[model samples]
Target chain A: MNIYNKVYFVLLFITLISYLGGFGKKPRYVRMVILLMILWFFTSAVAIYLVKYGGLTNNLFVFHISTPLEYVILSMLFRDVIVNKAIKRIILLSVPFFVALSVLFSVFIQPVDTNNSNIIIIESVILVFISLFFLREILLLQQVTVLHRFPMFWICVGILFYYTGNLVIEGMLNYMIRQSMELARRTYRFGYIFKYLLFILFIIGAFCSKSPRLLTKKEQ
Target chain B: MIISVTVVLLILLFFIVSFLFIYKNRQVRHRAEMESVKEKYNQEILKTQLEIREQTMKNISEEIHDNVGQVLSLVVLSLSAIELNDTTKAAAKIESTTKLVEKVVSDLRNLSKTLDADNVANVGLVAIIKFELELLEKTGVYRTLFRLSGTEKKLNGSKEIVLYRIIQESLNNIIKHAKATMIKISLDFSDTQLQVEITDDGKGFDAGDSGEKNMHRSGAGIKNMKKRANLIGGSLAVKSVPSMGTTVSMIIPFSPAG
Candidate 1:
C-alpha cells in the first residue's frame, strides 16, 4: 500500500479500537459518534480502493451518502458539551437545516457527482465553532487539574485541528482541481493524512476517563 | 501565497492551543492548592473538637467521683445510723437526710446540664464562662471574679464553642499547673469586636523561656489555644513573667461568620 493508504487504514484501525473501547464507559452520544466514524472510515476506504483499482466512478457516491450523517453525528456530540440554552437550541435546530441545505446545494448548485466545497466549508466552520466553544467553556467553568487527560479536552483538540486544517484545504479544492489535478490531489491527500493522524487524539480521548468533576474516582 | 497562509494559520493554531493548555494547567494547580489548604483546616477543626469532647468527659468523671460520690456516701452513713426506738431523734435525722438528698438531686441536675454539649453551644459565651467561674469558686480553692461590660452580641454556635474551649483550656491549665489563689476573667464588647481576658495570680513561667527546645513542651498548649482562636478569626496573646501572673487575651472581630 501507498503511504496514503497506510495512513487511512491506520486511522480506520484506531477508530475501530476507540469505538470498542468506548463501550459502556463513554457517554451514549460519544459511542454513537465513534460508531458512525468507524462506518464512514470503512466505507470510504473501500470506495477509494475500488475507484483506484476497478476504475469505478460510482464509488464517490458513498461519500455523498455519508457526509450528511457525519454532520448530524458531529452536532450530536457537541450538544452535550454546550452549556448555554440558546446556543444549544441553535445547534439542535441547525442539524435539519444543514441536512436540507446539503441536499439542495448538492442537487442544484454543486452536483452530486463532484466534491461539494460549499457544504464542506460550511461543515468545517460549524464544527470548528463547536470545538472552540467547547474549549472556551472548559476553561471558564471546569476546574481541570490535568487538561490532557480529560476526554472532552482531547476531543475538542482533535476537532479543532481537523476542522480548521480541513477548512483551508477544502475551501480551495475546486479551484485547485481546475488549475492542476495533480496538485489538487496532493493537497487533498495531505489533508486526509493530517486528518487521520489527529484521530489518534480521539482514540486517546476514548481511553481517557470522561469525568468532568475532580472527585469522581475519590467519590467512588 | 496559499502555502504561506496555511503555514501562518497552522502556527497561529498551535499558539492558541499551547496558550490554552498552559492556562488550564495553571488554573488546575491553583485550585488543587486551595483544596488542600481547605482540607487541612477542616481536619484541624475536627481534631480540636474531639480533644475538647475528651477533656469535657474527663472533667465530668472527676466531678461525679469527688462531689456526687461524697454526698451519696454521707446519705448512706446517715441511713445506717438510724435508731428506730428513739422516735424524736429518728424524726430529726430523717428530716436532715431528706435535705441532704434534695441537695444531691440539685447537684446531679446541674452536672447533667453541664454534660450536654448542645447546651454549651446554645448557651451564651458569657453565661458559659460565668458557670465555669461559679464551679471553680464552689471548689473554694481559687477566688474567681467575672466582669462583663457593653451590650453583648451573640456569635455563631461553632465559634462560641471554640472560644469557650480556648478559655476552658486556659482555666484547666491554671488549675492544674498554677498554684494561684485568684482567677479573674473579663469580657468586653465594643461596637465592632469582642475582647476576652483571663488572668491568674499563679506562679508564671518565663515568656522568654519558649525557645525551640521548649516549644513542643511548654508552647504546645499556647499553640493549640492560638489555633482555636485563629479558627474563629480571633487573635490570642499570652504574657507571663516569673512570680507574676499569666494573662490570656483574645480579640475577635464581630462578623456574621463568627
Candidate 2:
C-alpha cells in the first residue's frame, strides 16, 4: 500500500473514533456529515481495492455513485447553517437537479470505462461554488465569533480546499491518463493530500465543542 | 503545461483560503468589541441602580430622624407633663397629642410609599411628582408649583423609574445646594414625547462652568443624572444663571400602544 492508502486507512480510524467519542449526538448536521463521510470512505476504499486486485477495471463507477451523494449530503448540512429561508430552499432544490444530472451524464453523456472527466469537472465546479457561497454566508452570520470553532466553517473550508485542488488536477486527468498511466497516478497522489487535509479538518470539526462560547467559558 | 496550471490553481486556492482566514479574524475581533461595549453599558446601568437605592436609603434615614423622631419626642414631652388629677388641662393636652400622633402616622405612610419602588410606577409619574411637590411645599422651605399640560401618557416602566430617580436627585440638589425660594415642575405631554421641566428660582450658578470645573465637586451627581438619562434613552439639559434660576429639563419619548 502506498502513503495515500495509508492516510485513507487513518481516516477510517478517525471516523470510528469520532463516532465512539460521541461526536454525533448533539448537532444533527454534524452527525449527518460524519455518516456521509464514513459511507464515502468505505465505498471508495472498496472500489479502489476491487479495481487493483479483484480485476474490476471500471473505477469511475464508484464516483458516479458517490460524488452526487456527497454533494446532496453536504448541501443538506449547509441548509442547517443558512439563515435565510429562500437561500435554503434554493440549496434544497439544487440537490435533486444535480443528482439527476450526475446520473444522466455518467450513463449517457460520458462513458464510465474511461476517466469521467466531464462529470468530475462539473462536480468540482459546482462544489467549489457551493463551498464559497457557504463561506460567505458564514462570514455574514454576526453571532459567530470564532470561525474555526464553528463546525460549518470547518466543513466549508474542507470542501473548498478539496474541490479547488480537485478542479486543477482533475481538469487535466483524462489527457494525463492518455499520456502516461504512471504520471496520472502520481498526480492523483497529490490530490489525495488535499483529501487528507479535508478529513483532518473534519476531525477537528468533530472534536470541536458544540457550544459557541465553550472556549470562552473555559477561559473564564 | 498541465503541471504549471495545477501549481497556479493551487496558489490561487491558497490565496482564497488566506483571505477567508483574514475575514474570519476580522469578524471575531468585531464581535469581541461589541461584547465589551455591551458589558460596559450593563455595568453602568447596574451602578446607576445601586446609587438610586443608596440615595433612597439615605432619604428614608433622614426622614425617620428629622421628622418622625422630632414629632414623637414632642409627643413624649406633652404626655409626661400631663397632671393626672387636672382633667380639663389633661384632656386638652391629650387632644393635641392625638393630633401629633396622627401627623406621625401620615408622615410614615408617605415615607413608606416613597420607599416602595413599585409605587412609583403604580401611582403614575404625574401623581408621584405632585406628591413630591406637596412634600416640599409642606416643608415651607420653597414655594413649589406643579403644572400638568396635555393628556397624561404612560411610558415604559423602567424609563419611568429612572426618570423619577433623576427628578429625585435634582430635588435633593436643589434643597442642598440651590438654596431656592421657589421651585416649579411642569409636565407637558405631547403626541410623541413627555417633557419634564424642574425650574428653581434660587442662587443658581453657571451650568456649563459648574459641570466642567466642579465635575469632582458636584459634577459626579450631574454625571450620574446624565448617565441615567442616556440609560432611559432621554436627554437631560441643565440651564442655570447665577441668581436668576436653574432649570433641569428631561425629554422622554414614548410610543403609544394601539
Candidate 3:
C-alpha cells in the first residue's frame, strides 16, 4: 500500500475504534454517524480488495450504490438535529428526491463504470447547504454557550468542511482527468485530506460530553 | 492544473478557518451579552427589595398616626376621667378602655405581619394580597374589591415578592393620582399562566398622550411597574381613558419546576 492508503486506513481504524468505544455512551446521532463510518470502511475495503487482488479493473460501482445510502443517512442526521420546522420539512422531502436523481444519474449519466463525480458534486452541494443552515440556526438560537464543547456544533463543522471541499474537488475532477491523468490522480489525493478531517472531527464529536453552563463567580 | 487545485484547497482551508474564527467571536459576544443581562436583573431585584422595604415603613408610619395612636389617646383620656366614687360610670369607662386597647393590639399584630416583605412566600400570594386590600379598606377612602378564580398555585419565592411589590406599586399609583373612589383587583389562574387585573373607577388620563405634561404626571411609576413585571418574565399593560378609569393587566407564565 502507498503512504496515502496507509494513512487512510490508519485514520479509518482509529475513528472506528473511537466510535465503537462510545457506542453505548453517546446520543442517537453519534450512533448514526458510527453507522455511516462503518459503511464507508466496508465499501472502501471491499473496493480496494477487488481492485488490487480480485483482478477487477473498476470497483466504482460499490461507491455508486453506497453514495445514495450515505446521503440518506446524512439527511436523516440533519433532520434529527435541525430545529426549524421549514428546514426540517425540506430535508424530509429531499431524501427521496435525491435518491431518485442519484439512481437515474448512475443508470444513464455515469453508468457506474466511471467515478460518480456528478452525483457526488450534487450530494456535496446539498450537504453543504444543510450544514450551513444548521450552523446559522445554532448561531441564532444561542442555545449552546460553549460552542467548542457542543457535539452537534463540531459535527456540523465537520460536515461543512468535508462537503465544501468535496464539492469543489469533485466539480473539477472530470475536467482534470481529460487534461492529464497524472494531474487528476494527484488532485484526487487531496480529497483524502477532507475525508481524514471528517472522521477525525467525528471522533472528537463522538467523545464530547454535554457542554456545561459557563460558571458564574459564585460557582467558580 | 495542480497549481489550480492547490489554490482551491488553500482557499477552502481559509474559508473554514475564517468561519471558525467568526463563530468564536460571536460566541464571546453572546457570553458577554448574557452576563450583562444577568447583572442588570440582579440590580433590579435589589432595587425592588429596597423599594418594598421603604413602602412598608411608610405604611407602618401612616397606620400608627391615623389609627393606633388616635385610639390609644382616646383610651388614656377615658382612663383618666374614670371616677372611683361612681361604680356605674367607672365600669362604663373601664369597658370602653378595654375595647380600645383590644383594637390597638389587633391593628399592631396586622401591621407586624406585613412588616416583613419576605413573608409573602410563607403567607402565600393570595393571602398577602387580601391583607393589603383589607388595609386599604380600613382607610374608608377608596372602596377596594378582590376576586380570585381558579386554584392558587405557589410560585418561586423571589417571583412572588416581585409580583406583590408590583401590585402594591399599582395601588399606590391609584391612591396618589387616580382620585378614584373604588378599585377592583382580580387574579385569574390557569394551568400555565397567572393573569392579574387591577381596575379603578377614577378620573383617568389619556394613555395615548405622550406629551411632556402627561409623562411628568405618571411616567416614572408606570415605567418602574412595567420594568419590574418584565424582570420576572411577565408583561404589564396599562389602559386608561380620560374620565373612563384605568386598568392595569399583567400576565405571568407559571413554571412548575420553579
Top model by DockQ, which number? 3
What's the C-alpha lDDT at position B182 in model 1? 98
RMSD of each: 13.4, 10.1, 4.1
Candidate 1 chain B has its poorest 10 consecutive residues by lDDT at B209-218
lDDT of 3 at B77: 93
Q: What is the TM-score of chain B in candidate 3?
A: 0.85
Quote the positional error of residue B152 for candidate 2 in Å: 24
Question: Mind giving the per-residue lDDT tens digits that candidate 1 earns over B89-203?
Answer: 8998889999889989988887875666435666677877888898889899999999999988888776777788889889999998888999999999998899999999999
Task: Using lDDT as the measure, name the better of candidate 2 and candidate 3.
Answer: 3
Lowest summed lDDT window (length 10), candidate 3 chain A: A211-220
Q: Report the C-alpha lDDT of model 2 over B1-258, residue by residue, as the tens digit.
A: 457547746765686578567776877676688689768766765665676678768867888899999999999999999998999999999999999999999999988876764346687888888878877887889899989999998886667778888898899899999999999999999988889999999898865555455444457788788778877678887877889978998888874420
Interface RMSD list for the candidates = 5.5, 5.3, 4.5
Report the C-alpha displacement of residue B184, candidate 1, in angstroms: 38
Q: Rank the candidates by TM-score, best first.
A: 3, 2, 1
Whole-model Cα lDDT per candidate?
A: 0.78, 0.77, 0.84
Chain B, model 2, TM-score against the native?
Answer: 0.78
TM-score of each model, paired residue for residue: 0.52, 0.54, 0.83
Per-residue C-alpha lDDT of model 1 across residues A94-188, encoded as one tens digit per residue: 99999999999888987877887788889989999988888877676555656666777777777787888789898878889999999898778
